[model samples]
Target: MRKIKKICFYVLLGVIGIPSYAQDYSISLLPFSTDNYDEFSPAYYRGDIVFCSNQKSTIFIDYTDEKENLPPLNMYRVEEVERNVWGKAELFSKQFKSNANEGPATFNSTGSEIYFTRNNNNKKKIGNFIDKNNRLGIYYSKFNRRSNEWSEPTPFKYNNPAYNFAHPSLSEDENYLYFVSDMEGGYGGTDLYVCKLENGNWGAPQNLGPNINTTGNEYFPFIHSTGRLYFSSDEHGSIGRLDIFYSEKVNVEWHKPIHMDAPINSRYNDFGLIIDAFKKSGMFCSDRQRTSDDIYAFTPLYPMFENSQRQEENDYCYVLYEDGAENPDPSLFEYEWTFGDGNKARGLEVEHCFNGPGDYTLELNVIDKLTGEVSYTQAIYPLKIEDIAQVYINAPDTVEVGQEVVFDGRKTNITDFDIYRYYWDFGDGRKTRGIEATHFYTIRGNYIVQLGVVSREDKEGNSEKRGVYKNIVVVGSLKERGRRTSD
Candidate 1:
């Protein structure tokens, strides 16, 4: 008689076997402008952060209105030499003008197309508006890398006559274009809309739903690579006048927006957030220091997944036995197992097994020394043996009469036991076949549904039946009684 060694593996729950470190993030402010009231909308594209600032110009005269004290803001580009060190800021003279206020910039993936908003006084002369000075509209300019010059800016064609359009952001795939607009037919002030960029033409815009926009204003919309949206909103639990808020799409619906807290946001205004997909470093403009608004970079230290930090322990063990033999190989071969937890082990004919029950990929690589060649790897999955095969039946527990209802049955355990046939007794003299069977109950009453499965092979060559039962209550109504049957 062979001695059967039953190695019981205890599957542990919530055990951290391997330690993981949090990803470190750092930021460096670019030396662009020391003058007060400057710098906003810092965007990273092709390894450079392009921003807007109101720095003192050496050649041009002061364009600020001495009475109102509004300075001219020109766009600038700052290149990063190393990881933390930023190169000197250079004014984009060829692209920006010295006339009116220019700011709130966005760039494409390749840094070829640049879109920005400019307060066009000339547009006021073309059309009269309530707030003439605040009549800002978006403009588009293409950058030619070969010549290192930007083309003349042109007004975007889709600007509505009712409201101003600003703060444009392109989707990572560049298939959809999102921008903030105070146009009509919106839920509230300055609603965000996305339009499909089809064949180089912008299509009609659609509102981003009520979750993102409210009766109050929502602006500076930035979409991250991970599909999380970041924007500024004063209406949604903000710390101050305008605070940055972020929300992600779950199950095709946007969840309730949450405020970005403390260091990244302050009591003062924080807007214009930008993040790189690769490094996950975020940049935004904040007036937290009580000085002028400066561009600040922050590394988001939050875990990527909500369940990423929580480790699930496996303590249940699976016992592996040969198909017909009780005691097989004691020292005839080697053992190699992959635990699927980013770990692996190798030994020569060992009896020790794993300590947990989970989806593990195990492989046994054997060697033949006489032939000087390796044998085929044998793979086996040790499953928990249960007496009753737990089957989940997915169907309505209650249904109206004459309604076609679907019954689904899923069986677990008994891997080699093939279900040869299925018999569903609908308790109304009607029977059906197949794992997922459909039946219509005629006349309203309480009925018991039974699913019978037959095993393909048995010792006597006869099929063995496995039964599953479910109780369904049927309601009788005028509409349900009048319903016609397909048969």
Candidate 2:
């Protein structure tokens, strides 16, 4: 009982290291993440999220906690209305939501079988009792879609009342079950363990080894469809508390786990990570607000590329054109290239130089010379051509009306070319010429500001005109900050 009492405090440890890689994703609170109570460990199935909660305000308002004054964590499901919006959460099932604890569930690919955590209790026989306290154990339930009801739960074959076994994650093929437990000879308080599902029977559980099981707790294991193992740990270097980490299987071995950097791994307890089937986005649990646990969702803004296999870049800009066809002969395809810098070439491979610095559109037209079929592709290739002038403008995107605003171009890159002229268009019928200019807006509206630069040192009438545009918003002025004095 003393060891079980310490389980709740396992999430409070905060000393750890941060991941070296940068986080290229954005995260926000799920709309249903309530401030009144705790919600965590979200498992996505189809369009719904099956999660754990201990709050009384949930749809299961009638579910009275049987574990003294402490609310028993129970499983609930919510329908995702949109990307970040979710409908009200409901008890997974009235009958399944027992007085005892039940939560942290996972479903198979078919969604017909579920593995969940529950207290060890058997109404029929004393032989099932590993000890008198009835510690945690794993349970399985089958869903009869035809009847729309879950079958009676059966205890996992390896569940022992003397120890704790929870947080199950199934492999893609459902051939292996990964879970967290405090079984004997583990690396720490609780370590991740896995058991194989062979011939309708679960084999002996095996520890995931030292690479994963640290001297601290590791829990909430999730296996992404891409075969990545994601879990939370307090021992591994973390931003704080329990940060999420993931490791990929390479050469039949698990690599060292990589920290999931923020805004995913904040200075808070973050765990229960499950990526969407598409692997583009997913959800996680965090107690960052210091109020109550909440669920957060994240999505990547760019394509995820392997860090070790990134293409090396040279000093000069270059483009590669591929046939992009299956097993086509190079001689059968003709290439037409447009550098978008007033340069064009026709060949399978050709290099061109730009005379100025700006964003350039490179187009490649591939023609099947044999069938006369043609296809084309284009991509924007930015170039900072050496000895060319580049202009950068800095201005507040929005400001109060009647406020004076400054537009500065001191950071502009004019490394090689000599600037002949600088022109500014304030979009309100006002024009000026200078490297830096200031203006005041009296009306509340949106204005487009344009900067045009003419640069060429040696030749007259050979100056190149480069223009940049930005939108500025003017709003009504705000009142001064409120001040209070002690009475």
Candidate 3:
């Protein structure tokens, strides 16, 4: 990863102050990126990646883009060599309008069906708008298992020759189709839109509304399996020309989109992002070089839940109720409950928060109402309150990458269990031993700090051991994480 980062861009240095907001993300340009050709809008196909490129294909014969002076964009496939590496790319398919512009595709779970964008060239004409020149629209193709061939591409049912509708992204369940279009009544040159597939037919297209679509173009939407909608937009006040933003659906409405942090979003045009369900790794497009758009892959140093609300606060408060009732018309008697703590209350039920972890004897007594004195003891209970019997890790959950962090294990509480040694795994292939230890991380990312305790061996040659794990986010230097448009 360090090598990949160096290959991608220079590491930031010399900045002094802290970043206003920072995230642990690392990005590297895809090895398949070419010098002059444009590559963007990557879609995952099985283990390989299918992306659109303007590089000439099949004997250097292809149509040229009407405006860009570049060759027509065609879908290309590249097998993943390994993590952070890719093989040479080849023409994705010939069944689709390969000679015309086509790419930015989405595949169903089985890869048998595909939804993509291409120049309008279907035979079926709809309504009076039929004079199409280069307007793009959504297209679909199905694989024939027996013939081992792809069916001829067909335009979407809602496709119209009068407007452009491209960059189709299908949901994982195949129940929703998201795309970009310049159709009338949209917020900008292009806006994110979706259509539900129900009863074997695609429903009317619905705009994602102002929260996502702005006066600036919003396009290249990728719906992740986690119900998150990620797309690129020029309207959300980005750090660059265009930036990728993601919005989670709250209830039935889409929440306001969040701008992706730096590195994932550079100052140049950055958009068209697709991430896996776990969000640990994925790819996006960026033109930071000012030459042509290129595909780049990104991964998180720390896993998710970094800033989410911590788990329900450790609960120590408990409720206690008297078990038996004193009969014989005890209207003249009152109840008095004394907890193990130095506190007493008069009631049938009592709720208390203990001061510390220990064992004590609690007593319930019947008091004489007139004399205000204890009559007799009704219940005697042995109550034991102890901290969770496990190895405990005490440290900050978030810290700078190179800042030394201290881990304390003296708080560990186990009844009758003696610890002989304390061990630490820094989650970065580093380990040490101590009841208290200090460690620092080299690069920015999230690491699981582990603490292990070993008990002394008894006469029987048996010992008890326990280990615990906690997540700690190691942020990068402010200079490195600072948002920027260029080097």
The top-ranked prediction according to TM-score is 3
* Model 3 residue 284 CA deviation in Å: 0.6
Name the candidate, 1 or 2, with the larger lDDT value. 2
lDDT of 2 by residue, 1-487 (tens): 1112323326455356555544557888887777766788898666688888766634434434333334566788899787566789888876566655676888898778899887775332222222436677899999888999999999899888678888899887898899999888998988998999879899999898888989988988998766678998887777787889987654345667877767788776788899876667888988887777888889864321122121111234564554452333578776767787777776756877565445767766676777765654433344444422356567888987556689986656555566666677777644556789877665568987777666654456454556666688887666311221221
- Lowest summed lDDT across 10 adjacent residues in model 3 is found at 1-10
Candidate 3: list runs displaced more than 4 Å. Answer: 1-23, 121-133, 303-487
Of the candidates numbered 2 and 3, which has the greater TM-score value?
3
Ranking by lDDT: 3, 2, 1
- How do the residues 388-466 of candidate 3 rate in per-residue lDDT, one tens digit apiece? 7666788888987556688888887656687887777777654557799877665667888777776788999987777
Against the correct fold, how does model 3 do in TM-score? 0.61
Which has the greatest lDDT? 3
TM-scores of all candidate predictions against the true structure: 0.55, 0.59, 0.61
Per-residue error for 98 in candidate 2, Å, reads: 0.9
Q: Total backbone clashes of model 2?
A: 2
Query: How much lDDT does each candidate structure score?
Result: 0.62, 0.71, 0.74
> Which pairs clash inside model 3?
267-485, 301-446, 302-446
Number of colliding residue pairs in each model: 10, 2, 3
